[model samples]
Target: MTAPVLEMRSIVKTFPGVRALSDVSLTVAPGEVHAICGENGAGKSTLMKVLSGVHPYGSYEGEILFEGSPCAFRDIRASEAQGIVIIHQELALIPYLSIAENIFLGNEHATRGFINWNDTLRHAASLLKRVGLDEHPQTRVADIGVGKQQLVEIAKALAKRVKLLILDEPTAALNDGDSAQLLRLIGELKEQGITSIIISHKLNEIAEVADSVTILRDGRTIETLDVKAGSTTEDRIIRGMVGRDLDHRFPERTPYEGDPGAHPALEVRDWTVHHPIDQQRKVVDGVSVQVRRGEIVGIAGLMGAGRTELAMSVFGRSYGRNISGTVLKDGREIGTRTVPEAVAHGIAYVTEDRKQYGLNLIDTIGRNITLSALSKVARRGVVDEHEETRVAESYRGSMNIKAPTVFEQVGRLSGGNQQKVVLSKWIFAGPDVLILDEPTRGIDVGAKYEIYTVIDRLAAEGKAVIFISSELPELLGMCDRVYTMAAGRLTGEIPRAEATQEVLMRHMTKNTR
Candidate 1:
């Protein structure tokens, strides 16, 4: 290839306890869509941060040459000045601001410190049209869905006159249609000679749009394949990323065939929870479920299936109003309806939205881990700080929560590490029944393996585990029995041996009003 548009040679970066990247090299040709594929903690984000000046010039040892000229960008603005823009996996958008305002936030069009509203609206509107976002510029960003917000982020990068755009897990939050649209836009950008890099875990997307693919494993570059050279295969890429073929993404499960109608460890009878809003309808319809000890029960459905609503409502009625549910444990009903009541009764919930509802971001990892079970380490309504620290430190080590110290803020950790904290918090609650929602959602492959082992161990310990996930493969692998839901109703229940994606998807899409 001729001189590439962007090149990074021998990039090396290390944290206190983690070597994030080592000898990573990449070259992106002008107008090409190069993909960086790796399991979680594969150093993809770290490398991109170095390239985009988030790490600055000296923090990491590397040589970044843009358009065949050596470059040093001290900050993100300096990199953008040279037409390189990066959209992080976690979006950086002002929720209350109008779409136009968010798009041109830092680089607003103004005169003498006075904003030019007309020009701003016209420019933002035109950019939105290019990205196929039909929403008005005046609309608040918070009002839009995740997919629309992603398109706006892209349009914002376009406003920066991006020459090389970096998107990190851009479609992680998007639905099927939005993901396709974003990929199409990249193709269109390529035609315009704007170089791009897309980082994603979804191998199908990589196969569709990537001109070249680089695989990073354990903070090292393993291989880079030329997709146009007829050597690219999804299997090959998976091997490079995880160092083995995941011939079977789902682990095999044995059927749990004890006596039917046996006493279940956790049971919800005729459960119902209404929306908190006045005149609101029931979010969770009359539903019922029974999970036996030492069983992993799976809930399968498409988005808004009310699976999560059902779980949260049952977990001490944390989600809704007018909640009427008879929660039975060991053949006896508990006359309790509070979060602590559930926890005290040996029922713990690990939420899907870990960031917002699970973790206290401002607190240290140690504190966050012990938050749920603070009373366990207290004496006469006073917490024993030493015991709390000891318990938190143990979970950090056992959960493999990577951090410089236990005192590190939970928010500063990566998505996977933060999730470990959430799991630790709930586990400390000493729950015999654990409600897990999307337990491995944003975590990396290596971390995912560890988490899988943890869940299996929990099942082995005879805990009634409710495993909820969007990925059907995980449900098939992990759950002892699978239950499918559609539009707030239980559609079907299939034994693990008989469960299949086709069967689950059929129930997942069962339309109900």
Candidate 2:
């Protein structure tokens, strides 16, 4: 029998007040796609960090064996020297740098004291071609879409002669077409005798590509299943990761039953927004939407279908240029020309890119939660820290933001917890209308259910909700009515009972004038 490619024995990792992982063991075979399935805070990322030497050797208790040889890596450089490379959830490429520069960064080809640009670009071009990326090596990283940037990241790993590749949420930000391409590339890599370990929340993608899956819950190994052996299923994986059988992925709620004649809680009519850079190109063109009180409306579309642009533009004109729109609340026209005005008018937008536009990562969770509504806790131009703590504590409990205290920095929390913090912030603002953009983008299935429940609760309390997501199933499960967008136009609107992946796809791909 062939020996295993990697083995980790009795690994235990701990923080100041929390034991993140306990007695975890993992084994991976050569030239196989291995998947690590776990909920947020279950130590999946921590284990990968330990293996890649992000936490170094002495900081954790573990034994790592790579190709039957015991390994002690003091840093990521040492791991990379052994043909091990990890691509994090966030791409590390500099936006302004050329693709070739980003690909060979820190590992540039040089002849003794002199740098070699010719060899660098030549090698980068070959690597990009190998990964199915057709762009020129000199193209700036910012010029390409997110999907291509992911390919560049893989090309960077290839530049290191990587034998074992680790990807964290590789497809979280990619569209369906891009995700399919990346998965195909992974299969091609397997055919080339390269091993891969992927940490992903997308179970369907795992079922499609993984040869073996290891499940973890609360920092311990639950079980490992062989995919070809007919022992692995999405439900079984969910059961292991969450420590319970998630019979229902979404919370149940009553459908909207508002009167047709009554005005919607929020309405946008003849909304048009042009691209910020391309002055003449329209990003959102004459789109209209209405959300009745206590209703959850969803906008479904492809990657660049203008769903996000429409939401951002409607929310105090945060995005786009040459914007022309009329927003109405309770049948009366309201101005949303700025963020403060939008908030004052009881409108809140939870952005998709949480790290960039939502939370202050360096600040405490308490501060981030109360950032939007400081006046509620302040008096006579004087801020009260004690009252702020009390309010944050209340939200921390209500939102189930798993943390030791509200004083902890927001950056230290998991993706799921960070999302909860963003939600808590908007909820504290007491908005009558909420626009949530990809609220569960990189979170686990268990966390998704919690977020759905929060949305349901908000709708139940008579708040109009506009949910925008790329996943069709989420729209069908949560939204009362779904609108499809194509080429900056509203293609179709389907009631929840009539919505399906097939029907949504047709509308999403429809052509417009």
Q: In terms of lDDT, which candidate is strongest?
A: 2
For model 1, give the 10-residue run with minimal summed lDDT: 250-259
Indicate which candidate wins on TM-score: 2
Candidate 1 structure quality by residue, lDDT tens digits, 1-513: 577999899999987676899999998888899999888778899999999999899889879999989988899999999999999988999999999999999999999999999999999999999889999999999989988999999999999999999999988766567889999998998998899999988777888999999999988989889987877887788788889876755444455655467789998888877877843777777778889988999998776678888998888788878888688997989855888888888999999888889999999988898889888899999999899889988998888887877888887777778888898998888899999998887665656777887887787777889999888878987887888887777888888888999989987888767
Candidate 2 lands at a TM-score of: 0.99
| Model 2 score (lDDT) | 0.95
Q: Clashes in each model (backbone N, CA, C under 3 Å)?
A: 1, 0
- Candidate 1 contains a number of clashing pairs equal to 1
In model 1, which runs have C-alpha deviations exceeding 4 angstroms?
A: 244-252, 277-281, 379-390, 403-409
For each candidate, what is the lDDT? Answer: 0.87, 0.95
> 1-513 in candidate 2: lDDT tens per residue?
899999999999998777888999999999999999998888999999999999899989989999999999999999999999999998999999999999988998888967699999899999999999999999999999999999999999999999999999999999999999999999999999999999999999999999999998889999999987877889989998898999999998788987889899999999999999998999899999999999999999999999999999999899999999799999999999999999999999999999999999999999999999999889997778999999999989998999999999999889999999999999999999999999999999998999999999999999999999999999999999999999899999999889899999999999897
**Global fold similarity of model 1 (TM-score):** 0.92
